[model samples]
Target: MGPELHYQMIISRTAELRTEAADHRRVRQVEAAKKERSEGGLRRSLFGKFSAA
Candidate 1:
């Protein structure tokens, strides 16, 4: 393949890989936040029960 064609291919592939990585990172952050919220809620509930008793 011509050098220009090869260069273009590499650039496009790199861009696609970066996009995929960013999406994965966003998903992981969202999952972590959700887990933290759920754990926090559970802690609050347990604390409330203990305090009540």
Candidate 2:
């Protein structure tokens, strides 16, 4: 509607983008950590079974 309103909208959008990016990054970090833990557990279990055999 006005110049000030347009500027405010732009700033609001930038903030939303930053917040979304941070959330995405956190989700990825958590997923990667879980994957690493799962792989580590599998490796240990397999190693134990092989060693016993």
Candidate 3:
């Protein structure tokens, strides 16, 4: 292949990889937030029960 075509292909591949990485990172952040919220709710419920008693 020609140098110009190779360069274009490389640039396109790099952009695709960057987008994939960003999407993966966003998914991880969402999962972490959901886990934290659930844990926080559990803690509050446990405390509430003890405090009421």
Candidate 2 lDDT by residue in tens digits, 1-53: 99999999999999999999999999999999999999999999999999999
> Which parts of model 3 are misplaced by more than 4 Å?
none
TM-scores of the candidates are 0.86, 0.77, 0.88
By TM-score, the best candidate is 3
Q: Cα RMSDs of all predictions?
A: 1.1, 1.7, 1.0
Candidate 2's displacement at residue 37, Å, is 0.5
Per-residue alpha-carbon lDDT of candidate 3 for residues 1-53, written as tens digits (9 for 90 to 100) = 99999999999999999999999999999999999999999999999999999
Candidate 2, superposed: residue stretches over 4 Å from native: 48-53
- Tell me the deviation in Å of residue 26 in model 2: 0.6
Q: What would the per-residue lDDT of candidate 1 be over residues 1-53, giving only the tens digit for each residue?
A: 99999999999999999999999999999999999999999999999999999
**Which regions in candidate 1 have their CA more than 4 angstroms from the true location?**
none
Q: How many backbone clashes does candidate 2 have?
A: 0
| Overall lDDT per candidate, in order of appearance | 1.00, 1.00, 1.00
Task: Mark the 10 consecutive residues where model 1 has the least summed lDDT.
Answer: 1-10
TM-score for candidate 1, residues paired by index: 0.86
